[model samples]
Target: METKIFAKDQLDEAVDLLAKGELVAFPTETVYGLGAIATNEKSVKGVYAAKGRPSDNPLIVTVSDEEMIARYAKEVPERAKKLIKHFWPGPLTILLFVKPGSLPTAVTGGLDTVAFRCPDDQLTHDLIAKLGYPIVGPSANTSTKPSPTTAQHVYHDLKGKIAGIIDGGPTRVGLESTIVDLSVKTPIVLRPGEITPEEISQVLGEKVLINTGKVSDKEVPKAPGMKYRHYAPSAPVVVVDHVEDFAHIPLNAETGVMALKSELSKIDLPEENKFNLGNDLVDADHNLFGGLRYFDDKKQIKQIYVQGFDEGEESLAYMNRLNKAAAGHHFK
Candidate 1:
């Protein structure tokens, strides 16, 4: 299969391909998502096959309008309605009880609940609206890899496996959406992203639950990224607890460092081996995945050492992704 790269204006081509049950990757503010119409079993299955994703790992349903949500979700409670009103078209994914058989087993992963997100990107909104149905969107990368933040990153992992990619440039968040499950009686977060639980609590005027514990492999996850060893590069990553910890290590060409620009200045590591994480939490979130991929491109970077941050609520999303990539490895 030839993977054609489509520009922002060429979504008509993308719509035509998707209608034919072909897979197309499109950008959201978060990351590029591998899109297959949720109603098409074959196309949705192709998404799992192409990405080598586990069949049991559920896919997110991306919608353009409230009508689509009403059509699929079993019941959108008052709290959920307020959340959608406040956070729709943003990096918040809500898990709700979906209508039975509304989507294929391939889409729901045979689960009764579905994850729904309405992205903030105009091009993606237009694509879904024009297609006239929701699409199953998983991060457009091979299973257990760093999620693709750019079209090139998608192409790097997917290439000829998919039909084409809609190049909407670099993603803003560089991480997946915050997934909160409303399917149960009490709402709880299954995954963390740019949207903090505190922010969600503020909008709903109720305290939100945030227990991001790693679900057991035997259990089917309610959300994506919850039961996978993800965001790893070719190199091993060591999480440095403090910036001054760099002084205890030996600097070499094969050793790479990912930290804030301020922290990078204090390390004696080679400029070529360092990837800057900017100066704050937001910047760190934006650059974290790119920094991992940057070392993969270098090839010779045998190991990566990254700076760790305080476990504040605002920094939870950044730390969640970083800890996953490092697999909870702290510097010795």
Candidate 2:
């Protein structure tokens, strides 16, 4: 199937296609999402099929606003309300007890709780509002691949598999949303994103549990991109604790290195084999996936090595994605 690229003005057409149970890839504040009407089982299944995503990996439902939560979620607790008031229309997804029979099994993965978020992007919010219902918007890429921040990335992975893609340029957050499980007594962060656990705790006037451990393969993931080795590129990625380590590591023509601009001169690799992700943490976060994709597209490069960042508040989300992309292969 030929995937059509829709402009911002053509969102009405995108909404129409979604209402007809066709998959439409659109932009969120965090990343590009492969969207399907959440209420339609067939459409929701198409998302998993198109992306080769695991059937059991639950998809997050994107809503227009806070009030729309009632249409899908069973009940909103008082703490959840506080979170919504502060973080709605941003990069934060809350896992709430879903209304029985309200959404398809394909959406919740047979779990009682459903993940929901109101994106900060106007185009996506308008698309959901105009469609008059929620849409399941997972990262618009093949399962276990780097999440697409640009529409071209989506087209490369899912061009013929999906119906259409709305090109809203690159995503601002450059990472997925922070997923908090409100279904439990104490809210636990299932997946970390732009929003930090400290921010959530400060807003709620209570401590939020941060679950940073990897989920065992035996357990079913409560959220998308949790259990799987996600955001990986075709090339093997190695994470090094310090940038200086890259100088000691032997390099060949087939190797590529992703490091900070300051560390690039220290690495022995050729200019083409080196990708400088700028100096700021935000710069690294914004270019993390794009750099991986860039090196992965180079046929000559087989091995990709990345410099690890500090685990500070801003860098936590950046490292989370990098660690997952490297598949925990870190060199001290």
Candidate 3:
């Protein structure tokens, strides 16, 4: 199957395709998502097949507004309401109890709770509203691969696998939404993204706990991108906690390194093998996947060494993505 790229003005065609149960990749503020109608069992299954995503791993349902969330989810708790007021139409996904028989089991991964997000991007909002139903939109890449930020990235990974892609340009946040499980008594952050736990706590006037523990093999992940090794590139990634230690690590022609602009001078690799992520955490978040994808696309590069950042509030999401991309291959 050939993948067609649609302009923002051509979204009606894309929505029409989706209404017919065809898969379409669309942009969100966080990343491009492989989208299908949430309530359509066969269409939802096509999403898993297109991305090679595990059936047991749940997918996030995207809606245009808070009003649409009620069509799929039930019993929106008081705490979730507080969070929705502050974080909706942004990059935060809330886990809520699923409405019986509302969504297909394929969408929920057989779980009783559903994860939903209302992206801040106007293009995606308009598309969803036009479609008039929720869509299950996971990151638009093969499962466990680095999430796509640009339409080109989506085409690179999902070309010929999906029906069409809506080119809304590069994503703004460039990371997945912050996922918090409100289904439990105490809200636990399942995945960290642009929205920090500190900010969530400030809005709720209470503390939100981060789930530091691992999910066992027998357990099903409550959200997508949780159970698997995610955001990985074709080349092996090694995380360096300190920039100065780049010298101690051996380098060869097949190796490349990614560092911040401030630490570029500290890296000992050849100029061609080094990529700078610039100075700010926001910039780092924006370029993180692109840099990894750039090096991975280089046929000569076998390994990629990435500089790590301090786990401060600003850098927490950045480091979380890096850590996952490295698959825990960290050097102190």
Q: Give the number of the best model, judged by TM-score.
A: 1
Estimate, for each residue in 1-332, the C-alpha lDDT of model 3 and write its tens digit.
Answer: 98999998899999999999999999999999999999899999999898988888998999999889888788877888999998888999999999999998898878999999999989899999999998998999988888999999999999999999999999998888999999887788889999998999888888788878887888889987667889888898999898778878888899898888878787667888888887867888988988988887888999898988886777878888898999999876
Candidate 1 global lDDT: 0.90
User: Residue 172 lDDT in model 1?
Assistant: 94
Q: Tell me how far the alpha carbon of residue 230 in candidate 3 is from the true structure, in angstroms, after superposition.
A: 0.7
lDDT of 2 by residue, 1-332 (tens): 88999999999999989999899999988899999989999999999999998898999999999888898889989999999999988999999999999999999888899999899999998999899999998999989988899999999999789999999999988889999999998889888888999999999998799887776877768998778888888888999887668867779999999988988878777899999887877788888888998887898998899988886776778888899999889875
Pitting candidate 1 against candidate 3, the one with the higher TM-score is 1
* Ten contiguous residues minimizing lDDT sum, candidate 1: 211-220
TM-score of each: 0.98, 0.97, 0.97
Clashing pairs in 1: none
| Residue pairs in clash, model 3 | none
lDDT per residue as tens, model 1, 108-178: 87889999999999999999999999999999998877888999999999999999999999999988899
Can you tell me which runs of candidate 2 are displaced by over 4 Å? none
The regions of model 3 sitting more than 4 angstroms off are none
